[model samples]
Target: MQCPQIVEPEKSTQARRHALWSTCSPPHQRNSPMATTCPARARVPLTLQRSHVCQCVFIRSPARVGAVVSRAEASTAERRKTAVNMRTPRRRRHRSLTATAAATAAIAALSTSAVAPALASDQPPVNIVEMTPELTKKMQHEVDTFFAKHDLPGLSVAVVTPARAGSDPVITTFVAGTPTLGSSELVDATTQFELGSETKVFTADLLAYLVATDRVSLDDPVQLFAPAGVEVPEWTDPQTGATTAITLGDLATHQAGLLDAPPNLGAGCGADPGCENPRPGYTQTMLWDAFAQPCLNGQPCPMYQPGTDWLYSDWGFGLLGTILANVLDPVIETEPPAYQSALDQAFLDALGMSSTELEFHGDGRLATPYKADGTNAFHWDNTNAISGAGGLISDATDMGTWVAAHLGYVPSTAPIGVQAMADTLQPISDITMSCSIPDQCGPAHFQMGLGWELHHAATHDVGAAWAFKNGLTDGSSTDTALAPSLRVGVTTMYNKRLSDTDQGLPLAITLLKLLVADQPAPEPAPSAAPQAALAESGQPTAELIVPGMMAAGFVAIGLLLIIRRRGHGRRSTR
Candidate 1:
């Protein structure tokens, strides 16, 4: 068979630009040196791989330009699978590859097949699970209805279907409405959105990681990791006449009787002698100062005895980050802020979250935030002491990986990956109760996990386990939810600052329930990339399932076989 040839475009100017952009960065911009060789398999705790994981199948095929499928053989698939499943890259090779962004995107599009391997150290695996047509229509309707009525500018939601063999975590993403601010680009998988307080979950996860390794104890008093020279103004039990030290669990569960923030909130860093924010990007310093000056108006601030209260305090989390950073600094041997670097190691680097980062300023891209009134809102950043409170910047794609790990599906090579996830999901306190048993419990009854808030009664009624953390920021709102047993999680985010009556939280729950419905999943997966005949004409078309290319190839081969048989019959007649 002969194929048509395409002509090449003039490359005079393009060649010059490509050469310029491909050049390596200077010494100052280069990433820290990492080992030239990687280990065969990073040592992961045995506990990380208990059960229910959908191991990603890595198929290394020839990625044709302008194509979505790759053609590779058994040996190539094994090698690529080893890179992702066995050995997790120790550190990322941050390079001066700015010019290669487009080139990289082109290659990535080819690897969007279900078995695309995340071989490049910097590239997190991309998994696309084409959902049922009816499911797509249903989710789109829900997304559109919320955006239309709520006056939200833009929103992105990603759902993970029940995992099946021969695939990575089955992910389906929906981008709805045009963003009111920033580049006005359509909200998609790669777009970075502020994680808001959902960051606390990561912070709590870090603590759990440490606790799992015996490096720290959740029951230890807060003073254990406090910076030297900063005195934790003790709160004594009047009846016992002994100081009631604040334990780490108190902060993780929000049971610590601490203020939401010190002195001023949402104000710029002030140079005055007494200001909540004294310096930019100095969360640890500010956290230490808050405790050192744990008094207001020359008197100790109001703080109920530790473990007796359940007030949500961002500053309390800031203090926790400072403590965790101090403990993790020596262990990781990092020059950056200890806690921040530790987080990068556990999640961004080791756990394979390529699209996530701690800070946003001077970063590549950001989804602009807006107010409910359709006006621009300030882009809230967690540069100050409150980063542990809400400093994470991530996309729905990265969040899907995170969701998988928490659901005990995709375990990481990190020492405490699976254990930390379980610990974070454990219930710790009560938030509000359900209305199911009005006679036994009041309507305002709910449960709070280490980082996630538990939703029982209603969720249990549907035979699903649900938990979530609603993130609130001045410029953005984020809702992160989980359905553990059903193995589905969702992240709904909008640049718009949701007001009092916002439906973003409920919207996430509704979509999540639909994703993890009680009905059994179709064998393999019913969804595949739309074929020409099926997408175009109304005909009985073959479904190109999981690895979209294989099914397409089968259909093509069948038609060709019929053609050859007809040709032979004609020759026989002659």
Candidate 2:
């Protein structure tokens, strides 16, 4: 029952390192490289419904305990400490060590190698989700339930599993509903949906690719890439009266101390309050104005010292897009397209994300966004400057490929190096969330990776972590979650922008847990009160509410009749 001790190859050859790092599920007795190291465990049935999942890692130790970690575990711990410390301005480099080689090696050695064999363990067997009649019906049933229960206009989902022996990585995709309510056409793999802030991950991916290629550095000042006459904001510590310039790392991790949105986002709004929308996008001139003086009181004021705290800011990411555009424009041969073209060249195109784009020029494939009431909703338009903040439009297939790449499933066609994708998942800053009940939070830790939200469950091996991101626009929403150790990635796309209280997030998170650990999903604890709120208020449908209202009305009528009868009896007695 004991997992055998794995002996690291002395040479650490490229192939050996790859084999050591490519674990997807629990150990199997055949085919998988990990089968030789980790033995089998009993299978656990999934108990949680599709709507109760939260962001947590489920790691089941092999049948035996006391397994020794590989050599890389110590170095990874040191690097994580260093990466966390680097968030301070005193140590501003902010680059973590590359993917933990030994920790991954140990995980690979401990995990079941083949996807099918994972069925024998407490892990659901990772299978390729195709558009077969059976799978389509199953997915459609789930999608219909969500639509009826949660008010979703439409949905498309994709999940990626690591490759099994003699097989390619398994990608599962399913779509239900139409681009618009009246349209007869149902959404498919190619139908594009606005990604919203999910675009930030792509921006971060571009940054990582550039850094991996040595075209940029994490510590590079935002000022370095700005076009002439454009100024980058400076942060002044109010108490210390010391100042520092924001760097790309600070921007990527939301520690740049910038406002959530640029002040000029409402520029030229005149009297129309609704004109404040960023969907029209920020122009270069407006972007420059904000950068020159972020606070607009003739001051380049930042809320706090750069690199000192975490504050999610669309303005910061917008500025990042501008910087990346500046860095990429010189290298572009023809008239520079939207900054997205650079992203296409960097990874999207290479990774088979042909349907993903920042700009939609009458693409027939673009899904019609809808409101909760099934009415048409506005699709966000992005200018080059703010495109990276929340502008990319993508489909389930492309999103799946992007998530798969993070788990070391980069296809040979992808010229972009795997290290580039890995770099984006590196935890750069520790994120402390306020939990009313700290113990309920368990040993789960949170961090800001390049653009991903990193969640580490109780595991000594830092490599065993999950990274995820959520996106929302006026009309649509997207959620993507990945567990690299299990090589599992799950994403959901909705035509309607579901509320935070909706089941969209819980569904994705729950699906991930089901795949990663087949054990019954625990209910959301007090720490996940928001998730608990989902059961009560998350997009209740008319079918659920109308009957209750009818019952209440019937009861009220009966009470009124009783009162009238009592009054009649009193009059008779008189």
Tell me model 2's lDDT, rounded to 2 decimals: 0.59
lDDT by residue for model 2 (416-448), tens: 433378778888988653222212222225788
Please provide TM-scores, in order, for all candidate models, with all chains considered together.
Answer: 0.62, 0.62
Tens digit per residue, CA lDDT, model 1, 104-172: 444344335432322435432223232455665677688888878787766777666543342234555
Candidate 1 regions with alpha-carbon error over 4 angstroms: 1-131, 165-168, 179-184, 264-268, 271-283, 292-302, 330-336, 361-364, 411-415, 429-444, 459-463, 503-505, 516-518, 521-574
lDDT of each: 0.56, 0.59
CA RMSD of all predictions: 19.5, 26.3
Least accurate 10 contiguous residues by lDDT in model 2:
40-49
Q: How high a TM-score does candidate 1 get?
A: 0.62
